[model samples]
Target: MKVKGYPMLASLLAVMLLVGLQTPAYGENATTRATWIWQTDLIKDGGEELLHFASDEGITLIYLQIDRQLPPEIYEAFIKRAHENQIAVHALGGDPRWALTEHREDMLGLADWVLNYNGKVSTGARFDGIHLDIEPYVLAQWEDETDEVISTWEQNLIMFLNQASGSDLELGIDIPFWFDRYTLGNGTSLNEWLIGTFDQVTVMAYRNQVESENGILDLTRDELELANRLGKQILIGVNTKEMPREPHTTFYGYGKESLNAKMEHLSSALGSYASFAGIAIHDIRNWQNMSSDVTVPPDEEEPTTPPPDPDPDPNPEPGEGDRVPDADPITRDPVVRGTYIWEAHEVIRNSQEILDFAKEKNLNWLYVRLDLEQPYTKYSSFVKQAAAAGIEVHALGGHPIWALEENRPRMMRLVNYVKNYNRAVEGDERFHGIHLDIEPYVLPAWRENSQQVISEWTANLDAFVTELKKDSNLEASMDMAVWLDKYKVTGQDMSLSKWMINRMDHVSLMAFRDKAEGSNGIIAVAKEEIAFADELGKPIKISVEIKASHEGDHITFYEEGAAYMEEELAKLPELLKDSPSFTGSLVHAYAYWKNAKP
Candidate 1:
């Protein structure tokens, strides 16, 4: 936040850093903390002054979004038992499909469910990573109609913040304290693609009901004086719960002990001329998950003579003209087609028998898993009430601390607890994309503790889908299936066609498994896994498995194996005609259209 020249962004800032992707081995611990978001839903609706402004006062980073999603061998032993009790896990990348409720691939499927669950809890450790709570560029009021799609997606979000830029994995951008009334800060393209790619931004600052015990809590000081006059690094946002706005028009939020005395009185009145780099509690909010008693110490010091490293040696390699650049033109957009049901939890809580079997069968996508070791807020409120009855969400759940493999600071605080699982509603402003049903595995008694958590979950799911396809306000993917050769015949050392081949646009391949018994024949195994995901050249999206486990008594799909898997799944136009590595097909469920709309 010390903006005098905002860290002197030397020359196009190393071509704005991040180009190819995959960073985050996580080690740094410089420590100047303060990133909390413990959603104590206003101390059970704002009572004990939001629990004495949260456990006796002075809060530090606590952010929580855990609804459900956990199975990578129980979230890698659940974030190494919460960093041996230090409590630093913050992932909350959401999906209520913002942009005033359009489909825009459900904001790129909620930036592919927060970059493959922030690449499976930043597979390693030494925590403190992401917090991008999907704020759909401000649901389109002005951000200049998406500022030329955010200046052509700020060169792939500076190559996904140069592979999610980091020291000990750090990146934040929960934005939307409404650009603090635009004093140039709002010329817009999502506020110059988030003040030109984030290293810090957290906002949603606070909304409506304006205050009460600490009632209408404040602190949007114009997006913290425009990220402290553009040195860009600030975190404010409010709302510990009671949302309302118009009808009941609530907003009177506070109570994690009144937003921790409103973030230590806005970091003691904006820490010494705005270097106050932390607060972000608008969500991960719910009061019961308390524990703050009082901490807020780090008053921003280290300047004894520090700040020198303009290019000091912290792994600064690239000089020989930094080669490996080209290939990211794929920019994730296989346009996410339909019908997906990895672990169909009681068929979406039987929402009218899965919307009368997806309107009688012409199914149109419904990939739901919603996990993080179960009891997920009633399946996250039944996939946000099945997207108000149209249906599209995809999550498939994970995180018992991502099977704690990389071990580095407990996998970067479990990649900020799965990137702050759906921060109440900016990206989830409701559903479409937020799926990374990531299914990594290896055997022979867990291959070397699952190869540093499966190569840190394949380089953190391709740097969380190249950092939410360069978050011009997120779009997403990564729902691979058909057990890619049974994860290489169970030895489980998969690169996944060179790690998500050309890094996602959309990918689906559950080519009817369990060794196609009496025949799920699987259209010649979905044309040999869509020609091995089109020989891994990338641009993928190939599906097939339209009817499984039927004959009642809990799944056996009888009627002659559901009529020969519906006549070999209607022979898929003679098994994908001239397969250009096809880009669609997803069934094996609303129970194979119970008789009409797909």
Candidate 2:
């Protein structure tokens, strides 16, 4: 959390009254007071005592550190206890370094860890929400590469929110109170965008007084007003923990009596705002020990360096410096906003719903499968309808061992079907491309005959791409797991993932992780793939799943519902803003996406 600025006086009578005042309950008329439970307090076996203190103090929320080192049962019991007392327990942990690309996967790992835990824990015992404390301004590079670092900060933030959106988790971020002073090159004010993006925001309004220019309410006024207008919640945070410099930074110097007085004044002054959720004390342990005799150091000096230039050219052409200077962008902007359609025939009957969905979601591409059992006329009509709706239809089909000579005909059949459809139809009614989803990993031969099967799988993909290009004028693409880059064919040194991307006009990464953030999740898995595609100048779509799966909860958002899935997908374009080859995204299939329960 970020802190800036300070305040003045309180009478002994007000201090005495403040100390005796009870912590308000959590409700609209009452302040929803919360506090951070540092990891240290949690490590000690004080769960019962912690709840007692919070309940007595009227803490409605406790941002608990996600300590995997502690037993799962510990958190379960603690959360169970907290919930019983009406205090929401949110998983909280983050570091400034997470803004770096290399460290982002680990940062996202925190969310995945929480999600995985929630999957196994009982619903009631699970975390009520996720509260991230990622303060990117603390990084050393932030001073020199302010624009780049802050952009990375927002990227990571959006990714984390995307992951949290996969569950029913209410997400909150801790931002410095002064974020309004910082603006992005895109004209987005940090505080405004942050508050607007999340479910709620807790400003680090860590001053000790109530009414002067640097007072608690004064510092938090901007956020409270903005949140009210946006219908988002804002929590005015205060400091209790003692720091090295500026004793005014915490209440330790003046004691709990003074602190309570200031908090009371803050609540009274800011409580009228609809967005003013409540006050959140910096921590629990420090509040418990208000007897430190720490001396005040001289006022800390502010950095002399000015912040990065906020207004960069917003209309640079493609292949210019819009992205990192390391790679050049494609001549044409990417056009891969797509979804797979397994029930190609059913689409004809449900053409309007499909068209409406495509138009509403800005989906421009469709990967429709060949249902041989359905009439050829049905496929043609659906393709025509899709074209009319401004959706480019890509003929989709695949089978394992497609690289083998014996199975090569199966792949050819799909290519031929699309060719025939194109030959029969004129202009816009014809298929725009062919998309293959052959996965050799699922084949029985993969395990029974490892080397040969692996070798054959790569060979088949190579053959298919080579043959498809020669036989069809339509654009060709294929889907593969993100880890294909890490895998090498039995006798070959080349990466399967890279090889596939290089050979195709486009590649869709079956980035399948339900959570969009984190290392093992969607964004991290696709990071390398996107970079490689950027280098190769091929367009790519990072696909996600909404369908139910026998696979683990971490792999699909079946339980998260459609609204949440949409929220997560909306974060993608911004998250991948720097990747020139990022064409957009692809939902796994039309049938599943439409039917997924909200």
Candidate 3:
């Protein structure tokens, strides 16, 4: 549902005339409260719990994401119960890819399923409407082919409308508030056009504050005015889910009381308008778990004042517990032609083959996965061999859960294992560094409580470095996603990318796009990270994807072949000549690249 960047406008007057619409049955003077149920399995698995939560939250409308695989009877049973509780259910389904012509069938299929299911269901079980949450801006094409993307997106919506013609079901769409900034070819704002085209338009006016510049009210004002002028319902959508990257967009840490107060204020300010359909929280799961008080638990809600910040931990002296005297600082070539070795056991079984491949590829560094269960001699022999061949080998291991406080020991164990191994080895046989591949965003808790995950991830990094620097001069490096620049450290003005670059000896940005250049390519996405690293005088390597990805053909060099990948990668040196921090590039792994067509 989150789309990046700004958009242009469009006019939908002609389209509206072509397809007549019916307004949903919102009782006279009754404020329509709604929530999204994105997890469709809940309909069959936890129907009672879901219905009870909806009734308690006073949610009048539920936007249930359609799961076509589920039995039609499950939908009927759930919708019937929801109807009994006076809650109307609307089928919801969409993807950013739906904006493309080839993906139109997926969009139309949702509509056909809903209409077909409605025909066989009882009145109470019938879906009241269809809600589309397609966010085309998330597409790679949105950056370079804005016009074409918008045109296709509009065409897809028209196709959807044409498919739904003659149906009683109302149509609605979720759009960001900034759609008004995008002026369509016909000179109408996209927001206004959408408001005119659909039976209802839910403006994602997601902000913790309801007033002030860039707040919910300011962002939604134009859409509200347009909705009023067009005499269409405009449901203001607020977010309860955690958004660590854009913290101000959600009322996650603000508590339920604050959310209710802000919604009350919003209602007071815009309730007079006929088009004001009322507030819609982004979802039900998070809203249900939102605390009544910001800082205090529901059971212990007496505290009114915020807790004071804790004192910072002082730096520990070297040679403390499990710490040895610091080893002399090691230096290496600034250039980083690296690749990952995920199967460490391969090094033991095929040392010569791995070395021959690395040499052939001219790789200078290897992030070799450390198998702690194996004897020390297994890694020692490979590290010594790699070092003699002028290749730096670093230990690599991580998991998503390693980002949480409860899982700190698991992460520390890896750090300690490497540190202890270094203490017992000769300089040439020792690991050059530790390369972490922790992708905390993959954790389910990351979506539910992102701020907490970020905090714990940061703490784990601190523990990692502290343990790493205890007795060795090992370099600290990690693989990070390119988009992490969007997130700021909770209390810091700097971005997460900058913070990591400043802390680590060097970092590898997973700029997975196949192309080295162009708006949606690797260079464009890694630009910010490279700049940040340059500012901090740190080194950064742009990592490319070779492993076949289902995401899209543009995501990997799999189909392009190794020869073509090298040809594209050959463009980086000249293009990034000015960036001293641009050390070099790294292919995702040895396994995929080894067998990749030449």
Candidate 4:
């Protein structure tokens, strides 16, 4: 059925369902696609006009997918038209299953040809980068092929980028937005592998879009907030045309007006914290020549629940040059467990000390902060040693650069660098996952005001994690909040921890900052976070503040508190569920872990 003929309500729902990576909603401001595209996939005629319009409208990027190999002449003409119009061009993926599964060498070679075509089109063409929309495991490849896919992506793509690094070419990879947060069939440890490798990363964040029936802005806000937070140079996607996703016609795409409105709202919400470097328009096919008059309304409260994210990472290729040491392959303890501080960075500034501490106390995992300036060796070595001693390592990330509020493109470089270093230098067995410590407070002041800024922040985070997983065998876990269970923290305006964690291997809750009197004790609160994870069947972990985080105002839970908690923890197994369900406990800091024990 045509979109205009669909029930107004249904069409509205379709137009706004998953606008900002969160949910379907009313007339709230929409997030715009920064990198707009003239997708060849299922696109109608006059696709060039959409590219022209995007360029005229000052959109930053455009992508065109090639169905099968094209003749050089046809490819050159397409490239020339885009360049003549001054639009940036990138590739979109839709390889036939046969090419993807059986004709592996040919498929990657085709990608290389396209990549070369993109290069030959212009300097870097309109934008200085290349994009791959490899939807992994949509169906199975041979077990051997799984590793081959990643190996080829890295060897070919990274090699290409390195060759052009001196020439000023930019490169990036695109993946399903939910990969980092959700466990899915075709995911990869891409961010980790490509860190230091790619120029930027984009995440696709739209599906089932719709405006609220009441025309209120509740649900849309949540999604936009999520998209803004999840990826680097995130380019959260929103479809320009109104159409139903196949099979069910269940999910609808976004309209131009709604998307623009969402972008404006996101800009307002994120302010300077708004790292939304830009938006990714799904297709120019749907974008009409004229702009829409859709006005984003103010946001309202969202639904009590949200749609689920894929719930659940990577490893090595067989090689004579080196055989990866076999690992026992320990799954995360079902009980809520989390570690802080590792994922990016080169050296664990204080390693030997931290590992001894984690091992002695029986902690399940350790979050290691490897300073990016240092080579990966110091950090990678520490993780191997720690894992050998029966403790897991989780790489932690904090910005090495002081300017956190830089443009999306710039920040993406930092994220990619960190993730790439982790994968290239570290081992799959030594670490359980990459842990994102996305403390938004440090963002440039301009970003502090807008919630969309936070969404952008998250998108960048997700991009790094997703990309890394493409190359490695680890899972993706992020540190979220303890506040999600009950009360909302006023003015903070970040994605709800639950909302963000919906796509994670499990969420790690930093459950502290006691303000009100008579609140549940820290362990009680931690348990609450775990319970929620259990309810969702998503694994959960807690960062127990064995010591007070700061000496100031918040309740100080130092050694005395740690001991009290440690004693309580000794009895924790007796309180309820299976031992595995509890995972393991994470204490705050090398300083604190040094002192506490069960």
TM-scores, all models, native as reference: 0.32, 0.45, 0.56, 0.38
Lowest lDDT 10-residue stretch of candidate 3: 1-10
Over 439-471, each residue of candidate 1 has an lDDT whose tens digit, in order, gives 433111123354555555656665565554442
Best by TM-score: 3
Off by over 4 Å in 2: 1-30, 40-46, 291-598
lDDT of 3: 0.77
Candidate number achieving the greatest lDDT relative to the actual structure: 3
lDDT of 3 at 94: 85
RMSD in Å for candidate 4, one decimal? 22.8
Which pairs, if any, clash in model 2? 108-518, 403-460
**Local accuracy of candidate 4 as per-residue lDDT tens digits, 154-249:** 444433443434333345566544444332123534443332133445545443233333221222333334434432233445544322112011
Of 2 and 4, which scores higher on TM-score? 2
Backbone clash pairs in model 4 (N, Cα, C under 3 Å; residues 3+ apart or in different chains), count = 102
- lDDT per residue (tens digit) for residues 120-237 in model 3: 9889889999999998875657655877877788778877877786678878999998887775566666777678878888999887666655677778888877776676788999
Please give me the total number of clashing residue pairs in predicted model 1: 117
Winner on TM-score between 1 and 4 is 4
Candidate 2 per-residue lDDT, tens place, 78-109, comes to 88888889989888888888877778887788
| lDDT ranking of the models | 3, 2, 4, 1
* TM-score of candidate 2 to 2 decimals: 0.45
Q: What is the lDDT of candidate 4?
A: 0.46
